[model samples]
Target: MGHLWVIPAGPPLGSALVEKSEVVIRNFFLPFLFIRIGLLTDIFSIKDWKAFVSLGMILVAAYLGKVWGSLLSLIWFKTSTRNDLLFGCFLNIKGIIELLVFLRWIIYKPIDVQTFSTLVLFNLVLTAIVTPLISIFYKPRKRLDRISKIDNCIRTLQSTLPNSELRILCCIHHEDNVNGIINLLRASNPTEMNPICAYAVHLIDLVGRALPVIVPYNTQKRRLVANSTDRIMRAMTRYSKGSGAAVKVQPFKMISPYNTMHQSICKLVEDNLIPLVLLPFHENGEFQSRTACVQNFNKNVLSYAPCTVGIFVDRGLTYYHPSNICYNVAVFFLGGPDDREAMALVSRISSHPGMSITIFRIDLLENSVESENDRCLDDAVTKEFMVGNVGNTRVECHEMVANDSKQLMDAIKKEKDFELVIVDFAEGHMMSLLVIQSVESIKQGAKLLPP
Candidate 1:
């Protein structure tokens, strides 16, 4: 029993005895003692009216005093009301000390049997109520590392200048996320003037590991922490090499539980001062259904991410053919922050020689032309690419109304084929951009591409 208390400061020795055995201690040691106290307690002893009233009044005063003090401290410190109540409840908890003191009072006959029983019952009731209330109200505070200060003043991402760097944080887990992301990076067409810095984050769910690990592949540390993550790093490295000129890639492997992984990603984004975060869409496709944990992780990241987030819905552009090849891409703009960002990315892709792009701007039948307030810089740039020779003959622009998918597909069916479609993450109007192709149609679309 004495040896059980000896704990080191790290790893298997300290973690197993202290961290891992907490559940056992909570369930067995504490509950057994509490049950024993309950069995020893006499319920009928509280029937004495004078003793009951006196003990109840004392208990109420003590509880209110703790609550008042906690409320004052929380207010003075400007803490949240939920935490204020939780702190009060935590302070009100009567653990073994209270029980022991009361037991001593009983042994010394400071109170009669009825009074003692009432006081004990008061202690137990207050403790029970406080424990549950605190549990309900308590939430852990969000903490960020030291890296959140860089570019913290910037509000939104802007278009890169000729000499500017476009920094992106890309998150991936499954191999299914590989193709579309690589294609999207290719579309960016990093050049000598305006370079691209992509941080490829391979998020792995921590299992039986004692500590979270962050492994950087840019260093010469060749010890593979995880095999699957190693494969992802290698693939990203190859992609980076094949993408010539100003494309730089740094692979990072993070091992954390899914519940807290979003926080890690946010810290990474803040540290890197990344302007954009690309995440895989959380819907089930033909290959795999999204796991509940991963879906929840995605939701949390979307909610708490420090940078602009784009959820890519990969509709099998690379699934059919080699990702190294150039793709026929289309951009659908429905007018929102996300759509603007998508268009800005596509504008960069238009500069690539091997890429062919078509911009589809959706318009309402009631208003064929966009209002002044609705027009943005992204719209202006797309229009410039349409008429000007910046992209020369590679880019084309078209306008569409409510029912235009049928017409657009038919038009593409006539002369050319579109391998990938990039659209904003929006509902109703933008969803029309994600057109499903049958197996036969996919084969036909592939044939239309130049060999």
Candidate 2:
């Protein structure tokens, strides 16, 4: 009955149900089973000298058989000697299946009491030592330590080389998120000279399964049970076809617990050398019920991600079809790394024929102190953007000065007419203040993109 639930035609089960079942089994049934087995086994049977010798022989034979058997099986595949040995060590661990078999054999008189005691002791001893043996034998490589400081700093739009493919990991939570994300992708200005490689990952909560899985869209034999994933895939496919080699998308479905979802995402980013990851804001109406889970996932991603992370708040961009309407984008730039990244992304968006970008460079008041290094970098990035888009009527730049959070809020309120507002969550500056205040002050029709 438990196995049948995994069938495609079976009734759907929620993650909560599986979680409750696991808790019950682990807390109640497993302990009872172990206690019953302990009561049935006789430790005195293995104390005799002859019994001790027989038990030692059985342990040696079982260890050799289990380890060598696994090693011999791996000869058909291409694997290193160390990995094969590690695999064998991992296979040495025995579990409830063996215990249940021992109980049945003892009840049916297939094995005597001495033999049963020897087998149970062998199982316990092997299981206990395998972990320490594995730890001693297998040492994993640290991928993060191998990454250079330059690589860490360059994983954003401002640092990407010219004519290079811009790789992005787009995380989709629901069908409603598809339209806003697709619009953003379209506004990225993919061209023959510079293409976009997008990895679309649909995150599903782990449910009704014993292990997590990441399934590729093209490899699945059956359609995904969730229609939301299918709809997102279809939308991405249509966009890919229409882009005519300017864009390529690889779709994946990652089913994992919320607590560990960010690890999978970060691993994907590291493996693919993705520069940017786009995430939906957790405060969206669709996510309100699971706000805490979604927020935790986003926070974990931000903390562990090796690249830049963008939190997108979709207001009404879903209604703005990229093919028909021109997108009015406003960028609020303050001097910092995050603001520079926002500017770099806006530079790309400004190149799209359907995009009109307004750059608002906000400066701190004379009374406020600024970091010289950060100010220099910000100026360099802004200068490069201006030089790149010289004489482009679609792009406009404005400069503003604000003394405090109130003035910054007023400045943002004046620009509420734009369809999209881009800001950076720059710490220890007016930018962060603006982000906190603008959440409520921004017009209802404007989308917000904060990195």
Candidate 3:
């Protein structure tokens, strides 16, 4: 009667209720109830007054469905209002059901792939990003810190990055009262802790008066997020101290899974330039697992970036697992000013000892002239892309020209699923082209890659 979906997922809450509550999305298990009860039969199919009632019911359901799901999550999961809103938005944003609808409509198979994907991506992106944003951006009065100059501090600390030229650098807190923090840095920098390199730093804390209340930190019993954090820190410290740090397990206070860690790392970045953050991963099935910061950073801040980030999933500081995680990387090139900048980014992390890289010319096209002058420019284009090597990752220039950027994106999309998509998106020019594809992909519900 409220015309809303609760969770929008999982098994039956009973057919009688589901039949009336299925709304418009048919892929979910409840849609069968809508059909069996004939709620959508003559009303929707015949487009009669019955259909009018059904449509009204569906609209109501979507709204209530989202609300119920959010409220339930907040209560059952002990999620903060911010997390509950995010969870509700994620649930109700609606998509697995979208595919079944498209399948039903696939009789009209002459669909535009990019255009269709764009609509879907745009809808989902707005819902996913914006729905929770309302909750995240507006916060209670208690959490605001007076020190709002973290960005300036970030700049000052950035200049102090150790081995600014090295492929991999570890910034540690060799003498912090926060044992967990110290242990983590210690494990990650197992080589030799350069006492001068590690220092204090901070990021724009998630707790802004303007932002929503944080996910409750003290709810540590329900497989708390910080448990994994401790494991990661210990691993890094052990690696840094070379089995010598002998740090025993000690429980730390509750930590914010995503935002707090981001701020901590940002603070660290102010003093140390560790491009990669090695986070501990517990197999507890969380999307924001070890790479939460990576995803968060890519989504919220990388474009405004001063740097690129690598998120580490710890596998203990064993002799076999050393400091090596992902030494292999891939870079995309479009042969533009941004492509040149992307190459410069490669310089920061390429110095690692065993990193191997594959560079792709997703698309490069120059007018072929009958005269030699055209050929001269083509050669220059090739030379412009020649960004030597960084550390162990030998930059291999893989060249292939496409009819256009969509085709290039298509080609790259079909290739291997990469950990990251590095694009040379220097404003204007082809950057506009990528923006279109990005929008289309986003509309179709794909996450955005760092530009």
Better lDDT candidate (1, 3) = 1
Worst 10 residues of 3 by lDDT: 430-439
Give the alpha carbon lDDT tens digit for every residue of 1-451 in model 2. 2555444411135555665687888899999999988987897876576867876897788778867876775668866777787887777665789999999999899988878887888788877888887888776423433342334545667668768899988898888778788777777788878899889998887876657777688633567464767778888888888888889999998888787788788788887888888887777765677777787887666656777788777664635554665767788776677787788777777778877888889986742566898889889989999999998999898999998867887777766577677777525221121121233435432323223
lDDT for every model? Answer: 0.64, 0.73, 0.39
Q: For residues 1-451, write the lDDT of model 3, one tens digit per residue.
A: 3786554221123333444554543466556643432321222233244644564566557756886777886666776776566565556556445644543343366543333343344444556766666566655322312122324222321233443322222222112223333433333232323231332221112221223222211222444344333444445444334545322222222223344344434333333443333222112134334344544543332222233333222222222243453444466665443444445445443544544556775544532322465345534644544533423335566877787655765776666543333453324221111111121232222333433
Question: How many residue-pair clashes does candidate 2 contain?
Answer: 0
Estimate, for each residue in 189-281, the C-alpha lDDT of model 1 and write its tens digit: 777677888899887766546577766865345864645666677777887777676778888988777788888888787677777787766
Residue 88 of model 2: what lDDT? 78
* lDDT score at residue 162, model 1, on the 0-100 scale: 35
* Models sorted by lDDT, best on top: 2, 1, 3
User: Following a full C-alpha superposition, what root-mean-square deviation does model 3 have from the true structure?
Assistant: 17.8
C-alpha positional error of residue 76 in candidate 3 after TM-score superposition, expressed in Å: 50
Task: State the displacement of the C-alpha of residue 7, model 3, in Å, after optimal TM-score superposition.
Answer: 34
TM-score of each: 0.61, 0.74, 0.35
lDDT of 1 at 216: 81
Clashes of each: 0, 0, 36
Where is model 2 more than 4 Å wrong at Cα?
1-28, 42-46, 60-89, 112-141, 148-155, 162-164, 191-194, 208-212, 219-226, 243-246, 257-260, 283-293, 363-371, 400-418, 426-451
